[model samples]
Target: MEMDEDPDTLPAQRQGNIIITKYEQGHRAGAAVDMGHEQINIGKYANHLGIMQETELPPIRALEVKQRRKESKRTNKWLKMFADWPKYRNTKKLSQRVYKGIPLAVRGQAWSRLLNIDKIKSQNPGKYKAMKEKGKRSSRIIHRIQLDVSSTLQNHMMFIQRFGVRQQELCDILVAYSAYNPVSIPGQRYSWAMYPYSAWVSPEGVSTS
Candidate 1:
């Protein structure tokens, strides 16, 4: 019953039961904790990025801790899988694992592998940088891209600012892609195509090459 145990190792029924128990406990205690001063204290330290939050209720905090622990266990599993990717790559088990969930820590790597990004980069060396430079020189689509960049993912904390880091990164990817493939139009649709990839992958790993 310890929260520290890896839920992934347990039987499906057992894992469900444990989560349900924790949720019920949190539900029962949620009202009492909301009426106390603990809510104010927890709210102050809560992460604005929404990655992690300390709830006002102790029971809910406990549930969150349990969930975080579960995610950590899953992340460790992914680390092992990534370490032996060749063996597991293109396997049904890999697909099942992805269907189960990809932990945020390894999500970018998983996506990169799935998309064959590294292979593409290898095949076309220096192409992404060259396209980026080309994108810079092209003024035809830059205005259209600029107009859509600010509105894409506007509510998300990372893209809230007019020209924030993530927004800029997104813009760069779209610009580069537009330049790399002139047939593709640069617009809101292109923003949607690059937004999630830019959001998940680090700057160094991301490319439209």
Candidate 2:
């Protein structure tokens, strides 16, 4: 096989990346900004600020919380028996602080303080309200990302195999994306797949055509 010329001079792949410069810090798409790609709203990512914070709960403190909440309800036998709510509530300052450092939980209500629960919820309230509604999507580069999905992050790829994100989110975004841009589905490019409004593309890399 013949090797192509300098290869070094080939136009850099368009992709997305985190940029840390003297003036600003943020994720930038590869070599150039792709205006055509559908961007996830800033607020969705911003709402996860608590994931980076620190928490201060000793292992023992957690157990103590369960015990205390259990003891607090003694007014009625039924109430005491039904006092399982404390195991779930966050009245204790320690628990409140602990959730700060823990990985983000999927149970929406529990992670409220940890992340901007209400704010994020409010931002996408309509999507959540419509149980059948789909997730936001992007048709900008589904083919490109799908090509790389298998080789990208093991976690993402593996999760995509096992416990993938709810399909509706991707569906809604892609359907809407198709209307905005005309990229075909990865391997199924011949068939024009129309996604719902909520389907969307994640800004994972910077690659331009």
**Which one wins on TM-score?**
1
What global local distance difference test value does model 2 have?
A: 0.31
Q: Which number leads on lDDT? A: 1
Which 10 consecutive positions of candidate 1 have the poorest summed lDDT?
48-57
Off by over 4 Å in 1: 1-60, 185-209
Q: Measured by TM-score, how close is model 1 to the native structure? A: 0.62
How many backbone collisions does model 1 have? 0
RMSD of each: 19.9, 17.8
Question: What lDDT does each candidate get?
Answer: 0.59, 0.31
Question: Alpha-carbon error at 66 in model 2, in Å?
Answer: 19
Mind giving the per-residue lDDT tens digits that candidate 1 earns over 82-175?
Answer: 8998998999988998999787667777888888888988998988778765655442445556666656644444454445456566666776
- TM-score, candidate 2, is 0.25
